[model samples]
Target chain A: MRAKTADKIATSIIIAVAALIVLVLAGLLGYILYRGLGHISFHFLTSAPETIRKGGGIGPQLFNSVFLLVLTMLITVPIGLGAGIYMSEYAPANRITNFIRLIVEVLSSVPSIIVGLFGLLVLVNLFGFGFSLFSGALALTVFNLPLMVRITEQGLKGVPREQKEASLALGLSKWKTITSVMLPISLPVVLTGTILAAGRVFGEAAALLFTAGMSSPRLDFTDWNPFSPFSPLNPFRPAETLAVHIWKINSEGLAPDAAEIAAGASAVLVITVLLFNFGARWLGRYMYRKFTAIK
Target chain B: MNSIIEINDLDLFYGDFHALKHVNMEIPEKAITAFIGPSGCGKSTLLRTFNRMNDMIAGTRIEGSVEIAGTDIYSDEVDVETLRKRVGMVFQQPNPFPKSIYDNIAYGPRLHGITDRKKLDEIVETSLRSAALWNEVKDHLKRSAFSISGGQQQRLCIARALAVEPDILLMDEATSALDPISTLKIEELAQELKDRYTIVMVTHNMHQAARVSQQTVFFLNGEVVEYSETERLFSNPTDQRTEDYISGRFG
Candidate 1:
C-alpha cells in the first residue's frame, strides 16, 4: 500500500510537469498570436517597404527568405546525405572514423553565431560573394550541415540489422541494398531530420545577418528575368529574410511603425515554423505508410 | 548420394576467439542435413560460412575451402553476391521486408534485374505456393507482409528465399520461434522443398533433426562429434558424446 501511494505520487509529479510544459508553450503561442494577428492584411504581406513612411509591407523580405531556403536546401541535401551515408555504412571502425564522428558531434553543438562569423569571413569576404543571397545560402548550409549529417546517420543506424542482412542474403549488392531497402525503411526518420533542419534553417537569423546581409535591394516582381538585379531569382543580390527583418526593424527603429512590423513579422515567423514542424510530421507519417504499406 | 557441398579443414575465428577448429563434412545434394548442437557450438557459424554471410562480421576470419558445385566460394574470383544468390538463407526470426506480400517475394527476383510484370506475378505465385502459404495470402497479395500472423510470416520468408531460384537453402533455427503447428508446417514444407534445393538446417530440438533430416551432424566444443545417417546417429552407439546428446543426458 505504501509503495502504491509512492507510485501514485511519482506519477502525479510527472503529469504535473508535463501539463506545466504544455501550458507554458500554449501561453507563449497565444500571446504572440494575440499581439500580432491584427496587423496581417493581404497588402501588408505583398507590398514592398516605403523608406519615408511607417507601414510598408514585407514583400521583398518574405520572397528573399523563401528563395534563400530553396537555394540552401539544394546545396545542403546532397552533401549532407552523402556524408551521412558514408559515415554510417562505409566508414571503418577505426580511430580516424571515431575522430570524424567526434568532430561532427562537436560541430553540431557549436553556436550558430560563430558559424555565421566563419561564413562571413570565408564565403562573404574571402570568396568575394559580397553579402549576396548565394553567400547566405552557403553560410546556412555550413551552419546546418552538421545537424543534417548527424540526424541522417542516426536515422540510418536506427534501421534493424536484420533488414540489411536479409537484403544481402538475397544477393543485393551493398549499394543496392542501401539505396533500395535500407534507405526506404529509414525514410521516415530521414524525412523527419530534413524537416527539423529545415525548420531551424527557416527561422535562422544570426548566420544570415553577416553572410546574407541585413537589407534587400528592393525586388521588382514585375521583372521576371532571373538575371536582373531586382528580380527575386538573382542569387547575387542582397536578401533580407523575415527573421532578420524583424531584428533589423527592432534594432534600427528607423521605420515609423517598426514596432508593429516587428510584431507582425514575429507572428509570421512563429506560424511558419509551427507549420514546418507539423508538415514534417505529417510527411514523415505519410512516407512511412507508403514505404511500409501499413494500411 | 552425390555431395553438393564439401568443407575441408575449416577453421573459423572471431578476432582472437576460436569458434570452429579443423572442422569438415560433406553435405549431400537435394536432402535435408541437420546440425544438432548446444548453444555457442559453432553450428550457426558453420552455416553462415556456406553462403559467405560471415563476411559482414568484423574480425571474422576463416581458413579453409568451402566448395559448392566445384567452385571455391571464398576465392577472389567468386563474387560474394553471386554466391549468396545461389545459397539462400532463412534466419531464426521471421524477418519479412516491410512490403506487401507480393512485393516481398518479388524482392529477390527484382534485385537480379527481372522487371517484367507478368514474370514477377508468376514467380510470386510459384514461390508462395512452394512455401505452402499461397492459399492463405493469395487473396491479399497487396497487403503488408507484417499484416499476416507470425507463422504465416515465417513461411513468407521461406517463399522469399525460394523466389531467387537458389540451389541451396540455409535455415538457421528457422522454426524455433514458431508454435508447434507452425513448426510442423515448416517441417513438412522443408520435406517438400528438399526435392529441388539442398537444405541445411541447424536446430536445438533433437526430435526435429530425427524427424526431418536424412543426415545429422552433432557438434560439441566447436568440433563435429559425429556425422551419420539420422536414424543410426539417434539409435546406435558410435561416440559416447553423440549417444549422450541424443539420449538427453547433457546438451
Candidate 2:
C-alpha cells in the first residue's frame, strides 16, 4: 500500500513538471506575439529609422539584419557541417574524439554574454575587425558551431550501418561512399541539424554587441564579396542584425518611437526563424521521400 | 577444374585471439561450392576474406595468403576496390538499398561508369530477368526496392550482385532470412547463375547445400574437415567431425 502511494506521487510529480514546462513555453510565445504584433505595419517593415521622428521605419536596421543573417549562415553552415561529418564519420570513438566532443558541448552551455565578451576580446579588440558586420557574423558563428556540430553528428548517427557497408562492399572508395551513401542517407538528419543551427543563429543577439557594435543609421551593403571586408558596396560589412536592432532601439537614443521599431524588429526575427524551420522541414521530408523510393 | 580461389595456410586474428587457423582450400571456377560448418567454425569469416569485407572491423588481422584468380587479395599493393568489383557478396538479410528497383540494379553498373540511361535500362532488365524476378516486378521498375516481400527483395539483391557482372559471387547464408518459397527460388537462381559465375555459399541447411552445390567443404573448429563432391560429402564423409555434423549429431 505504501509503495503504491509512492508510485502515485512520482507519477503526479512527473506530470506536473511536464505541464509546467509546456505552460512556460506557451506563455513566453504568447506574450512575444501579442506585444510584438502591435508595433508592426508596412511602414514599420520597409521604412528607415530616424534620430528625430522615432516613428521613421527601421529601414537601415532591417537591411543590416538581413545582411547579417545571410553572412552568418554562409560562413557557419559549411564549417559546422564539415565538423559534424568529421566527428561522426572519420573520428573513431576514443579519448581524443571524446575530448573534442566535450569541448563542443561546453561551448553550447556557455552564456551568450560570455560569448559576447569572447568576441570582443578575441575577434574585435584584439584582432581589430572593428564594429562591422564581419565581426557580428564571426560572433554568431561561434555561438552557432557547437549546436550545429552536435545536431549534425546526431543526424549522421541516424543513418543505417548497412547502407554504409553496402556502398563500401560495392567497391566505392571512401570518399564516394561518404558522398553517395552516407551523406545522402544522413541528409535529412543533417538538414534538421542545420535548421536548428539557423534558428540559434537567428535568435541570438547577446554575443553580437561587442563584435558588430550597435550602429543602426547607415546602409552598408558591401560585405557580400567572399573575399573583401566591409565596403558600402559589400553586404558583408558587419551590418546590424535584427536582434541587435531591437536591443539598440529599446535601450539607446531615447527615440520616442523606439518601442514600435523594437516590436517590428522582433516580429521580423520571429518570422525569419519560423520560415527557416518550416522551409527546412519541408526540404528534409522531400529529400527523404526522393531517396527512399524503391526501384 | 581451375582453382579460382586458393587459400594457403590462411590465418585470421581478432586482436590476439586467432579465429581462423592455418587453413588450406581451393574453390574451383564456375562451380557452386558450399561451406557447411557449426557456429564459430569460420566459414563466414573465410568467405568475407575473399572480398576484404572484414577490413571494416577494427582490430582484425590476417596472415598467410588468400589468392583469387592469381591475384593476392590481402596484399598491400592490391587495390581493394578492383578486387571487390570482381568478387560480389550478398548478406544473410535481403538488404536492398532504399531505392527504386531500377536504381538497385543500376547502382553497381553506375559505379563502373555505365551511366547512359538506355544501357542502364538494359542492364536492369537483364539482371532482374536473370534473377527470375522481372516477370513479377516488370511493371514496377520505379517502385521502392524495400516495398517488395522479403523473398522478392532477396532476389533483387541477387540481381544487384549480378548487375556488376562479377566473376565470383559469395552468399553468406543468403536464404536464412527468407520463407521456404523464397529460399527455393533463391536456390534455383543460384544454380542457374553458377554457369556464368563462380559461386561460394555458406549454408547451415544440409538439404539446401545438397540440392544446390556441386562441391561441398565441411569446416569444424577453424579447420576444413573435408572437401569433396556434395553427394560424397553427405553420404561418405571421411572425417568423423563431418559425419557427425551431417548426421545431425552436432553442428
Candidate 3:
C-alpha cells in the first residue's frame, strides 16, 4: 500500500512538471502574438517611415533585412561548413581540435553588444566603412559562424564510421569521401545550422546598430550595383533592418504612431524566425526520408 | 597459385603500442586466403596495411615493405589514390552508401573519369553479376543501397568494390554481421570471386575459415603463428597456438 501510494505521488509530480513546461511555452507564444498580431499590415510591412514621418511604410527596412540575411548566408555557409568538415572528419581528438572547439564555444558565449563594439572599431572606424549593409552582414557572419560550425560538426560526427570506411575502402579519396558520402549524409543538419544562423541575422539588433547605422532609409541603386568595381560599396550610408527600425521608432518618439509600427515590425520578425526554424526542420526531415528510402 | 602480394618483416604500431610485429607473409594470386584469430590479434591491422588505409590514423607507423605486383606500395613515390584503385576493401558491416544501388557501384569508375552512361551501366551490370547479385538487384538499381537487408547490402558493397576491377579484395569479417543463410551466400560468392581476384579475409568463425579458404593464416599477439593449407591448418596444425586457436582453446 505504501509503495503504491509513493508511485502515485511520483507520477503526479512528473505530470505536473510536464504541464508546467507546456504552460511556459504557451505563455511565451501567447504574449508575443498578442502584442504583435494587431500591428501587422501591408503598409507596415512595405513602407519605410522616414525621419519624423507619421505612418509611412517600412519599405527600405524590409528590403535591408532580407538583403542582410541573404548576404550573411553567402559569406558564412561555406566557411562554417568547411570548418565543420575539418573539425568532425579530418581533425583528431587531440589538443588542436579541443583548442579550436574551446575558442568557438567562447565566441558563441560572447555578448552581442561586444560583437557590435568589435565591428564598430575594426570594421567601421579602422576599415573606413562607417556603416552599411556590408559591415552589418560581416558582423552577423561572425555571430552566426560559430553556431553553424558547431552544429555541422556535431552532425558530421554523428554519421556512422562504417559509412566513411566503406567509401574509403572502395578507393575513394579523402575529399571524395567527405563530399560524396559524409557531407550529403549530414546535409540536413548542416541546413538546420544555416537556417538557425539566418534567424539570428534576421532578429539581431544590437550588433547591427553601430555597424549598419541609423541615417534614415534610402533606396540608392548606384551603390547597390554588383557588376562594377569603379564605384566602391559605400558603407558610410545608414541601413535600417526591421529589428533596428523598431528600436529606432521606440527611442526617437517623434512619431506618435510608433507603438503600432513597433508591434507590426515585431510580428514580421517573429513570422520570419518561425518560418526559418520550421522550414529548415521540414527540409531536413524530407531529405532524410527521401534518401533513406532508397538505401 | 602464384604469389601476388609479399609482406617482408612488416610491423605496425599505434603510437607506442606494437600492433603487428615481424609479419612475414605471402598472399597468393587469385586465391581466397583466410586470417583466423581472436580479436586484437592484428589481422585487420595487417589487412589495412596492404592499401595503407591505416595512414588515415594519427600516430600509426608501419615498418617494412609491402610489395604488390613488384612495387613497394608504401614507397613515397606511390600515389595513395592509384594504390587504393588496385586494392579495394570491405568491412564487417554492410555499409552501402546513402545512394542508389547503381550509383554506389559506379562511384569508383566515375572517380576514374568514366562518365558515359552506357559504359557506367555496363560496369554496374558486370560488377553486380560477378558478385552474384545482378538478378536480385537488376530491376531496382535506382533504389537506395540502404533499403536492402544486411546480407544484400554486403553483396552490393562487394559489387561496389568490384566495379573498379581491383586486383585484390580485402574483407575484414565481412559476413560476421549477417544471418546464417546470408553468411553461406557470401561464402559461396567469395569462393566464386577467388577465381579472378586475390581475396584476403579476416574471420573469427572457425567453420567459415575451413569452409571458404584454401589457404589459412593463424595469428596470435601480433605474430603469424602458422601458415598452411586450410585442410592442414584445421586438421593437422603443427604449432600449439595454431592448434589451440583452431580447437577453440585459447587464441
Candidate 4:
C-alpha cells in the first residue's frame, strides 16, 4: 500500500513537470502570435522598407536569409559528411583521433559571438571579401561544421556491428560496405542533423552581423546573372538576413513602425525554426520507414 | 572426400589472452563439419579464422596458416576481399541489412558487380530457395527484411550468405538463438546445403552436431579435446573428455 502511494505521488509530480513545460511553450508562442499577427500584412510581407512611410515589408531580408541558408548548406554538407565518414569508419581510435574529437567538442561549445569575430577577422577583413553573402556563408559553415561532424559520427556509430560484419562476410570491400550498407542505414539520422543545423543557420544573428554586414543592395528580381551586384544569385553582395534585420530594427530602426516590424520578423523567425524541428522529425520517420519497411 | 580447409599449427591471440592454441584440423569439402564446446572454449574463434573475420578485432594476432583449397589465405599476395568472397559467414544472430528481401539477397552479388536486374532476380530466387525460405517469402520479396519473423530472418541471413556463391559457408551458432522449430528447419537446411557447399558450423548443442555433421571437433580450454567421425565419436569414445561431455558430465 505504501509503495503504491509513493508511485502515485511520483507519477503526479512527473506529470506536473511535463505539463508545466507544455504550458510555458504554449504561453510563449501564444504571446508572440498575439502581438505579431496584427502587423503581418500582404504589403508588409512583399514591399521593400520605406524609411519615410509607416508600412514597410521585409522582402529583401527574407530573400537574403533563404539565400544565405542555401549557400551555407551547400558548403557544409559535403565537407562535414566526408569528415564524419573518415572519423567514424577509417580513423584508428588512438590518441590522435581522441585529440581531434576533443578539439571538435571544444569548437562546438564556443560562443557564436566568437565565431562572428573569427569571420570578421579571417573572412571579411583578412581575405578582403568585404561584407558579402560569401563571407557570411563561410562563417556559418565554420560554426556548424563541428555539429554536423559530431552528429554524423554518432549516427554512423549507432549502427549495429552485425550489419558491417554481415556485409564484409559477403565479400564486400570495406569502402563498399560503408557506402552501400552503413551510409544508407545512417541516412535518417544524418538528415535530421542537417535539418537541425539548418534551423540553427536560419536564426543565427551574431555570426552573420560581422561577416554579411547590416545592409542589402536593391536587388533586380529580373536579373538572373550571377555576376550582377544586385542579382540574388550574386554571393559577393552584402545581405541583411531576417534575424539580423530584426536585431537592426530593434536597436536602431528609424522608421515610425519599427516596433511592429520587429514583432512580425520575430514571429516569422520562430515559425521557420519550429517548422524545421517538426520537419526533421517527420522526414526522419519517413526515411526510416522507407528503408527498413517498419510500419 | 578431399579436404577443403587445412589449419596447420594455428594459434590465435586477442591481446594477452590466448584464444586458440596451436590448432590443426582438416575440413572435408562438401561436408558438414561441427565444432562443439562450452562457452569461451574458442570454437567460434576457430570458425572465424577460416575467413579471417578476427582481423576486425583490435590486438588480434594469428600464427601459422589457414589454407583453403591449397591457397594460403594469410599470404601477402592474397586479397582479403576475394578470399572473403569465396568463403561466406553467418553470425549467431539474425542480422538482415534492414533492406528489402530482394535487396538483402542481391546485396552480395551487387558488391561483386552483378548489376543486371534479371540476373539479380534469378540469384535472389535461387539463394532463397536453397535456404528453404522461398515458398514463405516469394510473394514479399519487395518487402523489408525486418518485417519477417525471427526464424525467417535467420533463414534470410542464410540466403544472403548463399547469394555470394561461396565455396564454403561458415555458421557460427546460427540457430542458437532460434526456437525449436526454427532450429530444426536450419539443421535440416544445413544438411541439404552440404551437398553443394562445404558447411562448417559451431554449436553448443551436442545433439545438433550428432544429427547434422559428418565430422565433429570437440574443443575445451582453447585446445581440441577430440575430433573424429561424428558417429564414431558419439557412439564409441576415443577421448575421455569427449565421452564425459557427450554424457553431460561437466562441460
Candidate-wise lDDT, in order: 0.90, 0.83, 0.85, 0.91
Q: What is the DockQ of each candidate?
A: 0.80, 0.62, 0.60, 0.77
Residue-wise lDDT of candidate 4 within A123-170, one digit each (tens)? 999999999999999999987999899888988998899999999998
Every model's TM-score: 0.97, 0.93, 0.93, 0.97
- Model 2 chain A scores worst on lDDT over the 10 consecutive residues at A227-236
Lowest lDDT sum, 10 consecutive residues, model 3 chain B, at B242-251
Per-residue C-alpha lDDT of model 1 across residues B145-243, encoded as one tens digit per residue:
999998899999999999999999999999999999999999999999999999999998999999999999999989998999999999894999888
The residue pairs that clash in candidate 1, if any, are none
Candidate 1: residue A213 lDDT (0-100)? 93
Candidate 3: Cα lDDT at B197: 93
Which candidate, 2 or 4, would have the higher DockQ against the true structure?
4
lDDT of 3 by residue, B1-251 (tens): 79999999998899999999999989999999999999999998899998888998889988999999989999989988888888989889888888889988988899878999999999999999998899998999889887778999999999999998899999989999999999999999999999999999999898998999989999888999999999999999999888877778875
Among all candidates shown, the one with the greatest TM-score: 1
* lDDT (Cα, 0-100) at A46 in candidate 3: 66
Clashing pairs in 4: none
- For candidate 3, the TM-score of chain A alone relative to the native chain A: 0.87
Task: Chain A only: list TM-scores of all candidates.
Answer: 0.95, 0.85, 0.87, 0.93
Compared with the true structure, what per-residue lDDT tens digits does model 2 show for residues A1-295? 9999999999999999999999998887777778878787888777667776657776666666666777888998889988988998889879999999999999888999898898889888898887777788888888788988887888778777767767677777877777666777777777877777677767777888888777643553544454454344354355566787787777785778677667767877787678778988987888877876822
Better of 2 and 4 by TM-score: 4
Candidate 4: Cα lDDT at A166: 96
Q: Please state the error at residue A165 of candidate 1 in Å.
A: 0.7
